[model samples]
Target: MATSPTTTGPRAPAGPGKDDRLTPRGKLALSLLCAAQFIIALDFSILNVALPVLGDDLHMRQADLQWAVTAFALPSGGFLLLFGRIADLFGRRRLFIAGLVLFTLASVLATAAWGLAPFLIARALQGLGAAAVVPTGMSLLTTTFPEGPQRNKALAVSGTILSLGYTVGMLLGGVMTDQLGWRSTMALLAAAGGIVAIAAPALLTDSRPTERPKLDIPGAVTVTGGLLCVIYALSTAADQGFGGLDVIATLVVGVLLLAAFVVVELRVAQPLVSLQMLRRPTVAFGNLGGLTTFSMMSSVIFLLTLYLQDVLGLSAFETSLVFAVQGAVLVGTGTAASRIVAALGARTTLVAGLTVQSVFTAALLFLSGDDDVWLAVTALALASVGHMSAVVSYGINATSGLPDNAQGLATGLVTSAQQLGITIGIPVLSAFAASRVGSLERAGEDARTALLGGTRTGVGVDAALVLVSVLLIGFGLRRADRR
Candidate 1:
């Protein structure tokens, strides 16, 4: 077995009781790390509102519109584990800065593109950049702050910014696209990425394992290809339905590749992912909680956006304003998340936070097609408190008890759950909604009414799934706690 070092490079000075307080330099480092996280989150949603305008400008086919998202989602989600292990073997800070530079350059290309092909190429490059950044950045954060209150506090801030970035992107995307044109959205990302890239080397410390293990080429290839296939298939199934030959074939290939990955990992000398690390109750259930929170919330947001715009006849800007309230609530909740985790423990906090989100999401079932904007706003805001808490606690829970050398791999899994949540949520719920809407339309319902019915079904199912997660994680973690 490869041994980890006692300390993760040079960190802030901390004695017996002073471990929680960060020095000024430590604070600066945390800020820069969180900024990287914020930009990644921002990139995910910022281009969404601008896609239609971009399509018009680039003369993109209606079918090609979704590529803008999938292009980014594929590489970013697929390559996380590979880059994460690479960071552990090489250096986290080096990869982090490199990723930011790539992301910034990709954003510049996106801004300059006159057609769809170049723009998608830029988006894929951006995703590849993000794949390097997310896990390495997270591992840096964990390694910087020792596990406990200090780590929890840092995660609270990072998690808060992560969620806020997505919501802010929604608001800014509409405003920027309307006022300055669609290119401004990409320009904003470029500016943010450039600034972060410039600041990272000065603010962050580089760390790698004492012994460099050979990179797991077979495991890496299988897993990365599997995830790309799965994500691409899921995204396609959302638009074209699961019955298509392409979607079915892609999904089967993904599954087979994933199975091959598992077989390779079991036999390999140094696996890309350590199966032993995944068996820890905290690691397993914590990731499950993280995936559920992100996926359900994302699906809920997708349903709400459709409800606000298509069903309620609100403009894109108005729809964003509704989401903005949830963003504000998240800011406050994130600030308090550390205290909650300290008092209740990570497991309890995870269960409680997820339960709260589920309760509020269930309230969305009350929304009708006519006039329920306030209800949507209220449910969104209230649910954000739980969302923020879960996001904060799950990170704490997942990374807790792991060794310093494993930080990169552990954080990789945590971040991968997050990316997968975003990749999977919308498609699963959208497919259900599309089916429900088609059925309602066939039953003689009007377009608006059918849409509302579909959204309601998606929201209700989302709420129930969350409840199921509560039981599974709550009990699963409890058993682990007792042991």
Candidate 2:
């Protein structure tokens, strides 16, 4: 195999004469990639609304019901980086198509599952497929479109579809579970996956680096094991809190294994990921921005779900309607994200987006029992504009100035930040709210009011964290963006 030295250093933007327009093939490619992304996002959330109904039907214990969600999340979050690297070495398109087959088959299995054990196994297989698809799809996009306005626009569209998929899944899950039964939710995923799998081969071109560098076995094992442990521990913490012996022990082991992975990568000749890539301001701050926006925003949604349903007495469908508003706002924002990056550059767009998100999220502090729940809806809608813009810009920033050969590694970090953010957000932030609720209850407050207080505090903290991140990311990336 022919080899070129890998370089992740900063590079100048495309010259004025370079054509930034997309051809017809580009449009079709974008459509296929976006479809894959939508299915991945949909699978992540579609099961939430159907969980209780599915649990009763399957005769699952209440304590074990959370596993339905965790089982999918674990492999999806844990194996992202490893599979991402594999896609680069083996073949992105090949792995992507293979992932679709696995995902589609798993969905069918989940739909036809006769009991709890089979269902959980099928869900894990679905997650494993998702692990392969997400990063590979992203890398394909990055490779398909050059690093410029064209790629930025494509990413904006992809990110918008991702947000819409989650929202639609929430709403669709409720309607499907109510009208067609809980199994119908899994069937829907199977149908969507089948369609995408059939289309993927023709639409996607095979891509891999010229150099077939040896896979870093020690690094891959340690990192994959570390991530699995941490994700499992965090998922358990979400339900059981951080006080459980198992959760604490798992977290400790996870951290130690991750530390060892870092050490192994440093010594290995063909490291799974180049630590020096982290030295690039765009990669470093971009991942940081992505992690914060995703984590904090997701935490806010989880908090609102409980508050709206438990405290305000809204039905599941009604709560979905409130989120639908945010989805609409994101759609509008996505249309403008590329233009915003064109005008302000990715770094400024990122900082400005986070600032806007923080300001509106702060508005949620005014929320109380007396106020209309629409107050929460309004805040989220405004915040989502920032959310969508940040999503687009962080992606551009992260993948900027890297060689095509390293695009997979760059996108792996990008997708991993996103996956881990979503996984870690609910547990960590909800724990804060839970603590506040416990303290208030101990102080003789009523259950409803105490819960309300806890939710408010959690929202406030989320706002503050995002606000602080604005400064950190801005300063960190100041030198990275010269445009």
Candidate 3:
């Protein structure tokens, strides 16, 4: 086993006593960490509203617009595990600050872009920075807050703020795209990242592993390559078809590289990800549960956004408002999550939350060309509440029992699950829904009706995914009880 960081580095301070609720230092830590997360969240949602506007402004097609997102997502998703391990070996604070600076600089470059290449390059740079920041910031949070209710409360706040950022980004992206230009989204992120950067050094202390493990060169190389290939494959599959030779080949290579990565990790003295860590029940199930929750939640957002704008002909601003309400629901539920988790246990909470999300997603099947809107809107809001609650509970489960040095890996695992899920889910589910639409259209349905029907189909599939998670958790909990 790897050595603990008791004497070697600035490990997280002991948990705050009840008497010290939101002390000055605690507030500062929370503020700083949350701020980083808030900015990252902003970047993710901001682009969704702006993609069309960007395609027009840059004189690019939908293909190029997808690239703009893929450029960012590839590095961010691909390099997360590697960067998380690096943060553990080197210093979490060091990587966190560095990533922030890099992200801000790229945002500036993106904001000033005049054409496709510069914009795509800048977005990729931002992703590289994000790959470092997400896990390291999360590591800092786990270490700073301690592993109990205090940490749960802090994570709830982070999840709430993060969900709020997505809401804000949607509204902001629409307003900015309408009033100024799509570039304004990047400008907004740059401004937010700057403020967080200034506050971070003052609030965060450096924490590194006690005995630095030699970088697992093969593990890092193979895993990074594998993830990059996988993300590329997913993006390609989403854009093109799975039948495309390119997508199939890329996906095959990704699977092979990942297999190689696992073998290397097992053989090596210092592994990028400790396979032993993956054996933890909470860690394993937390990520699987979280993956289903996030993927399904994000798929709902993607399909609904398209249905609202493309099918129902709602303006981007109006669509943003609808999602804004959902965001509020998420924030509210997140606020109450700590109490719920304490009372119910993370496992129980996870099951309940997943069940709620599944039910609401299934409710979307009630939506049709009738454009009642209430069915879609109500279900979305309720689903957001459950989704955010799951996020908090999963964060607690994944990191709760992890040691200080392993915090980076724990957080990285969950974060990777989220990114990969979003990346994979939107495409897979969307394709299924699109197929349904095609079938209906071939059978003589109107375009609007086909779109509405397609979105409903996607929502149904999303519900199925969440329901599967519920069953998985229920089964696992039953096994644990038997033991």
Candidate No. with top TM-score: 1
lDDT of 1 by residue, 1-483 (tens): 122464356666554553567889889999999999999988888888888888899998888888989999999999999999999999899999999999999999999997888999999999999999999999999888877778888999999998888888888988999999999999999999999999888888788776888999999999999999999999888889999899999999999999999999999999998888888989999999999999899899888988999999998878878887888899999989998888888889999999999999999999997789999999988888898899999999899888888899999999998989988999989998999999999999999999999999999999999999999999889899799
What lDDT is reached at residue 406 by model 3?
A: 82
Worst 10 residues of 1 by lDDT: 1-10
Candidate 1 displacement at residue 192 in angstroms: 0.7
lDDT of each: 0.90, 0.87, 0.83
Instruction: Return the top candidate by lDDT.
Output: 1
User: What ordering of candidates by lDDT runs from best to worst?
Assistant: 1, 2, 3
Score candidate 3 by TM-score against the native: 0.95
CA lDDT, candidate 3, residue 14: 47
Query: How many residue pairs of model 3 clash at the backbone?
Result: 0
Off by more than 4 A, model 3:
1-20, 480-483
Candidate 2: 10-residue stretch with minimal lDDT: 1-10
The TM-score that candidate 1 achieves is 0.97
Per-residue C-alpha lDDT of model 2 across residues 275-317, encoded as one tens digit per residue: 9998898999999888988888888888898889888888987
